[model samples]
Target: MARRGKKKGRPVSGWLVFDKPVGMGSTEAVSKIKWLFKADKAGHAGTLDPLASGMLPIALGEATKTVPYVMDGAKIYRFTIAWGEARSTDDLEGHVTATSDRRPSEADIRALLPDYTGLIMQVPPQFSAVKIAGERAYDIAREGEIVDIPAREVEIGRLDLLDCPDENSAVFEIECGKGTYVRSLARDMGRDLGCHGHIAVLRRVEVDPFVADDLVTLEALEAAAAEARPQGEPGEDGRIVDTRPDKERFAALDALVVDTGAALDCLPEVAVSDDAAQRIRLGNPVIIRGRDAPVEASEAYATARGRLVAIGAVEAGMFKPKRVFTGR
Candidate 1:
């Protein structure tokens, strides 16, 4: 008699962090990784400019459902400012709009840097993706029409002067929350010192739970891809049978994909018994046993049919359904 068999399932879902390479858009990288892993879904948590590189988190499969949770996490970057010149895009990508003949001392820049260390209003660059009138501001700027963008509040938690390479150049590290623009920060720094400034180089060192040392280069990824191919697979165009599988393809995929549980780290967890799990699964909230004392009445109850169905944690123990994961 033939042996009984079980159905095979898809790969486990998880989050992957990539040290994003320069010159590639975040969406493009996500697409390539999706193909490599043959995953049904994927998304990046944050957007990095083409000229910037570093910590990009990619959510895969069920983890893609957690994109919004991590979208507002803090980011840290190390960038250099090219003093004495300002650019249209606020970086090296655009044409120079102004230049300064004088250079300020390190002490002058240091004193000025403190002014930008807290919350302030920053005007989004005209050549930015910020939408105005249902179109990208950059698109409108490219059409030769000047765009008047209003300033928005963003917090700069920390701004430390790392080094001054020369009188015309300085490097710094910044830790800021969502929507803070380092490019604009550099521009403002220059203006305060009585000199024009533009970002010469910028690298994100960290974003929330991710760090810089964990990034892999595109070259390394390509090499790994070359080594992971199956043996004896026919080579393209009758070339040597180089069947080494492309590990980088999967590596890139792995870097951006995250597990659903990992993605929900921000939320408080409440362990449910088998009965409670069943009730919650069936759209009914069961009263939870052994819950802590209630502090905030609003968060203490999960209602069903005008009655308290489940007792939730008062302050931080409230059972908020982030994303429901039903296995991989």
Candidate 2:
């Protein structure tokens, strides 16, 4: 058997809750974070539209394994809907498709809030990532095609009218489950009140266990990178010739990361002994010894010596290893 070649970059692991500025795509943010950390791998928990700003959690290296948990978690968004003109993409970037002089009163908007709350059927915007016949819905919409997008059930846990800045627009804060589209909510609300509408602004403030305090802006990240970079002159090859200690360089960048296990905080955790952890690491189920250990859980994580070992199903007295994490 031949040995597999090692992957590139440092084994940096953790979640970097990013304040993704408007106009930057989610993929671009992930790429930039990977380059900044010089990590072997990186990924984001959820995709934020290019026009949307706020918490887009980027996971580096081993933290990528926990992204699904964050993605499945509830999201809180603060957005403003401009009432009067309906747009093609359901946001400011789109072309105006329809127009009306009608603007909903505060009473009208408040009355409509109940309709948006709880489980509701939503048809995603035309310019969205939803797939149609193996092609992206946005692609089809771009070709000047009007495709019928079916409505799907989405749960909005809480919806509130935050402010009505003027007669033209109103701000709202919504806490919704996975797959809820704020753009759709805006569009539907406008339609209901007889005023065409589109998203004027959008920002995600929270994703379950993560929140505003967890966020780090791109400007701050660049500043930390500068502080971490060794004082050096460019070599003949144009690469930096370092004049800083290894520890100093690592500490600056590593400080930006929240623990990889932080993303799994919502899940039940079972702290295990080293011997049992080693067995769990090797794809074997281990008997969970403590009386307080959950007897049955569909999804749980096992940690040993403060590091994550495996995420698995706990049945009876056993913790069955499903996906194991190697920090490297």
Which candidate's lDDT is highest?
A: 2
RMSD per model, one decimal? 7.5, 2.4
Candidate 2 at residue 164, lDDT? 96
Task: Give the 10-residue window scoring lowest on summed lDDT in candidate 2.
Answer: 241-250
Candidate 1 structure quality by residue, lDDT tens digits, 13-100 = 6666777788888888887666555666778888888899887887777666667666777889999999999899999999999999
Candidate 2's displacement at residue 140, Å, is 0.5
lDDT tens digits by residue: candidate 2, 123-240: 9999999998899999999999997899999999999999999999999999999998899888999999999899999999999889799999999899888776656788898888
Q: What stretches of model 2 exceed 4 Å from their correct place?
A: 1-7, 233-238, 243-247
Which residue runs of candidate 1 sit more than 4 Å off their true CA positions?
1-12, 219-258, 278-282, 290-322
In TM-score terms, which candidate is top?
Answer: 2
lDDT (Cα, 0-100) at 82 in candidate 2: 98
What overall lDDT goes with each candidate model?
Answer: 0.71, 0.91
